[model samples]
Target: MDPTEVNVPDVKDMNIDNITQNTILINSQCESERVKYLFERLVTHLHDFARETRLSTQEWKAALDFLVTVGQISSDDRHEFILLSDILGLSLLVDAIDHPKPPSSTEGSVLGPFHSHKAEVVPSGSDISSDPKGRPCLVLCTIKDPSGAPIEGVKIDIWETDSSGHYDVQYAEHDRPDGRCVMTSDEEGRFWFNAIVPVSYPIPHDGPVGKLLKLLKRHPWRPAHMHFMFEKEGWDHLITALYIHPDPYLTSDAVFGVKDSLIESLGSVSAEQAKAYGVREGTALISRDFVLVSDDETQRLRDSNALAAMADLFPGKKIKLLDHLPVPDLD
Candidate 1:
């Protein structure tokens, strides 16, 4: 039986809206087992939700229009719709399911909309401060195995919102990479770069997504944080964020990227330590260490399976998922 036609009223004289009939028609076309099951569940839940809320015709139409615009605004470099998904918590839910990292490894967060291409590769001790406006800081980091032994020669790509809490992409012609750097760890798996402390900033609010946030009365701010992408041989790559100590939005990050283990105290340095690190007394230095897991054949197989399952659910063309998300390919 045609699923769409099945919903037609028994009497020939009965009348129903075209929209409702079209929804049923689309569901009928989704005959694959997975798609069929998903459609049935979604339709049931949506119907129940509308009944429970006594949804008005205007409210439903506005929601559909908003989604249509969201898709329309998404593109190769910009993903305003993904940001909308993030702020609405769907992104976090997907991350949680995909990356249940081992207890020893820190939890991950959203790869926000502003991550860009072509961070200039540089050596350790060179300043990560491509622009001089953020708070002056020296970040000292160590990459180690779970057993506390260093993993040699890991590449760390780091970026963060500037001192003013705005990324370079926020401004059209910043002419410099603010709070972003590409550095490699040494033979001992230790790396350090000079930069300024990052401030918490709001997500972009000048677009359709922003208008929706204002309509919903939600704040657009994310906590002050540093974004890190690390990779080394014989180990799984890491893409994670570190939250600033005492940032007001730490607990309520708009993207829900804050993880307890990822928080580090931006330590106050003594005069002597300041001199050694080339910073002034009373300057804040962020000292943190990351532990990456070594992957055996078993772990590699598990990761592959998880990636396959993710592709099945999200497909290649929908939501970008992990396909476009960069990871180091160590062959």
Candidate 2:
């Protein structure tokens, strides 16, 4: 259905009994048909929510004030609104809806607010971890096609908190060499690095999100995991995490970002095994491979990634026909 067709709903004569008609009237002002449809649907649901809860004027004002504080606290280092969305699991839900992958292809996960364009690039096999705040760990990753063919020259960006559960950005110095670095796959599609094993950490508190959690009596912890982003031409820019299985929070991630297929085993290496890995005893090891879809099937995905990479700033960027897909009817 074309939401912007001639049948746009008008609510100029609407009364309290016909408040939903106001939403269709709001949709009439949107130039893009997809935007019109989305605004109409969102306004429809929002109006329903207000009616169902019988929300009062005071409650609405309080909600708006809370959101204003969230925006006031947001800055380059911290995004309180994203944190609010994470605590509500909306971030993961949006990711799943926007990027569905084949079983053979790497699954997507939350691209947590920590992604920085200033990631340090390190040579292959270099230690991104500055010191042993936690136990030593070796990470070995491989990138390949669904058919197990190696994909060389693929850029792999990685970052994680140290065992102390503190990201480099949390410190006073702007340039800390903690558990984070960027690397690339070689001819064999392999990229290996040394880092400290991460521990589960609470998402940042001291904001309105934390206040909401207090009101809801919810814990604010995420599972131990290393963030990975794989990008290359003709492939979907895969944003995912290699979650360390057995983490206590695996089943109860505060953000609901865990996927069963993304869970992988991590084990401690002995002296003999550690020697081959070029690490001493008591080093944890990670071994996993990611599969990418063939180029021919990724046109829509490529456009999506390009739009995202540019922050959707392309000139006259309208919703592509590919994006006008029918909303999945969960009912």
Candidate 3:
């Protein structure tokens, strides 16, 4: 482990032309091959971007400053980096890459910065809404495997914004949890709960990511949707949301998290039917069946060249994995 015995090439007098090569050479000495491969491409792309754009020193400094601010403002309750990733569509891309599912299975979406782990576990047909202004809605969901068999004992976490388009956490007082809860699927794979009909809302737009969005001339609104996270021992953990159809921002969600299959319409419920679901009259109903992929099936698909399978999921798009770059000859 002597420093003199280290095999990294000399990086002295690095200029624009040789700086990337020398950096990659140093990174190649990493003990982990995966880390080495990742940094090599990362360094190559980062340097290429600087060179291609002729990025000025001031611009580089500003970018670093922006990242610093993003970190400084993030806390236990808020995640600015995830917001940045979502805004840049990286979150959706990563989800698509790692959680590839069959056509029949539900697709994944962004787990936004507002997710709270402190949600209370509630029984079926319980109302999670705390805001009186929000319209009452009954969400009747069924969980099943890809083969259409009911999967019991699935832990499902659900959350959404109230009628005013703001989560409970977004409020200044934010003392108690509302509009979010955790429930277990019954033996029939059914779990119904009373919640407010979610309305379209803008993401937290008072931070650096919001500034970037403004700079890019983009709106910060997301479509009306309810978030759902499903977990079971044998099934793949699913993170998805059901978007309300005819939403203004459905086609142009700021986070690019919407998929055609996830769009659903709210059904009208009769007074008796609403009462049966434990909600008041004129309550809207969202009845949807979620199909989860098993871990074995997910692994099989992942091992069978997920990049190739992604083509079917994302039609009319070319997906490419980064090819390993040849190490530079420093000799």
Q: What is the C-alpha local distance difference test score of each model?
A: 0.73, 0.79, 0.87
lDDT of 2 by residue, 3-59 (tens): 667665554776657867766785667676656667777878888888899999999
The digit string of per-residue lDDT tens for model 3 on 2-97 reads 979988787799898999999999998897655676798899999999999999999999999999999998887789999999999999997876
* Total colliding residue pairs, candidate 2: 0
Off by over 4 Å in 3: 306-331
* RMSD of every prediction: 8.1, 7.3, 4.8
Residues 185-284, candidate 1: write the lDDT tens digits: 8778888888788888888887778898898898899888888988767776677888888988988887788888888878877898788877788877
lDDT: worst 10-residue window of model 3:
322-331
> Residue 301, candidate 1: how far off, in angstroms?
11
Best by lDDT: 3
TM-score against native, each model = 0.73, 0.83, 0.90
Q: Candidate 2 versus the native: TM-score?
A: 0.83
Question: Backbone clashes in each candidate structure, one number apiece?
Answer: 1, 0, 0
